[model samples]
Target: MAGYVCPVGSSSPHARSNACPPGTFSNHLHLFDKSQCETCPARFVCTRGTGGKQKPPVPCPVGHYCPPGTKYPAQYKCAPGTWSNRTSLASEEECLPCPAGWFCVAGAHVPSGRCSPGHYCPDGTRTSTQFPCPAGTYSTRLGNGRVEDCIACPVGSYCTDGTSKPTLCPVGTYRKEQGAKVSEDCVPCPGGYHCPELGTVAPQACGAGRFSDPGSASCLSCLVGHYCADEITSREAMLLAMVCPAGLLCPEGQAVAPDANGNACPRGYYCPRGDIVRGSVWLLLFTILSSSGLCFWEARVESVLLLESLPALGCLIFLLWFP
Candidate 1:
């Protein structure tokens, strides 16, 4: 009788008190049962009261749901990474995180679906947009959960766009630097160097007696009358070696002839061999002369008298024989 309250229309001392209905409470002490009870508002909970007093309605706690007519606090709880839009949610299923390729903030009712191609999103993200992968990195998959999901571009390779894989440098090209972002980042191999394979980091120098054109895959042998003794780096140097010097004969693969001295065979000299220095010819000449001389006086006088005495003796002998 002490905890009970009488009705408004019945003033009798023996009148019985009526209990408050569910979702509503009455807190008037020593009041009549006809007193108007307060109903719990949305997202609030109320329970039956005793001793002619009613419990005040309380707001719903976070992660816990309360319906419009909730009478108790032990209703429901939202799942992790999920949130409720408004109070008085009936079930935990109403709370949902952002979908794939999207981002959602805490307690967000709608997801931000404008994630960029080079970025990633995780559940329950509070930011309006996704995070971008760092330079020299890529994210091929969509809706990546963390920054670690981005991969690094390999050495000697390039990645131009976001969310793409590494591409190998083409032949005749090289990339010594790291983290190339485009195909043009690959440099052309210098002239007289060889770049035979893909993803070359450095160009190889041409071998001895071999030359290469600019951005060539392989080195070619020097042509006749041309030579490349060392790593020729330019076309001008190769062309200078290719020309044959005057008065000198050059064969294949030779830069200079051994017998290329500037001197030639002398005049009236025959040189049959190609080498004039080693071959020469000489000619012979003959001369004839006529002269007359007289004997000395002593010998010449004796010889003249002998010739006259012989003629006189011959005449005398001829006369004596005639007498």
Candidate 2:
């Protein structure tokens, strides 16, 4: 009696052979030569054997996946941040974390997507690209591609001309009075004190006294006993006032007044004894009253008497004799 061949897909196949392929086997019930089959259809695997004839088809092994475009079984690799395509995969692995201040767009894939350094994307905006920090804003903090925030300069500070942030204009330092062209145009401080002007130079002395140094914008107080009376004039009053003649004194009893010339008594009325204290005012009045020469002779004689006796009585006598 002849034995019936099993189906080709079952464990017990129709044909059998001792010379099976490395990845295939044969069964006992044979209707045709197993070595003659060159290829297997879908859902089956055929192994190479002697002389290009492949082994009989067998079901694919479990836990292995063959996606399109892959030629070899060893080319299979799991993607980052994703699960492997195998049911028997025991452990889940994650991709590397993105570096600080940087953002990763593609996870665990070779040639991963990334954002440029020193840039960020704001909320509601796509994070595929990086945007640079705008003028008037700055940040020292680390960030990813998602950072869109930057710090602003405070009041009294400005970063004109597209600076990263505002810088301070120091105290006592002021900008140019008008028509400043650039930060350098801010003038050096006036005389007495110093400060950084327009973000340069440390503070320094401007000049002496409230009078500012020449060509400077700042000022200082006058030195003791010396006065800066006006924007242009110097208050050297004592020096400017007239010096009395060798023996003459001013009629006001003071050696000096606004004028430098001593206040000598008038011609008709002499300064009694040439004493400024006893007869200055009277002599001034008498000199005006006796302008007609009426008291000229008596004024001379009274002047002689005053020189001998410079008392108030002599001054009264001189006043009485006035013409």
TM-score of each: 0.42, 0.26
Candidate 1 lDDT, tens digit per residue, 1-323? 22334566655533434555556655555556534655656676665442232336666665457666566665555553566656656556667765545665444445644455566666655443446666666766756766677677676788754545568889998888777878888888787798899999888998666777887888776654344556653455666644433333333444332243632323432223222221122211111112222221111110111111111111111111111
C-alpha displacement of 148 in model 2, angstroms? Answer: 5.8
> Per-residue lDDT tens digits of candidate 2, residues 56-75?
44443332332322222333
TM-score, cand. 2? 0.26
Runs of candidate 2 exceeding 4 Å displacement: 1-102, 105-119, 123-129, 144-148, 155-194, 197-323
- Write down the lDDT of every candidate, Cα atoms only: 0.55, 0.35
- Cand. 1 TM to true fold: 0.42
The lDDT leader among the candidates is: 1
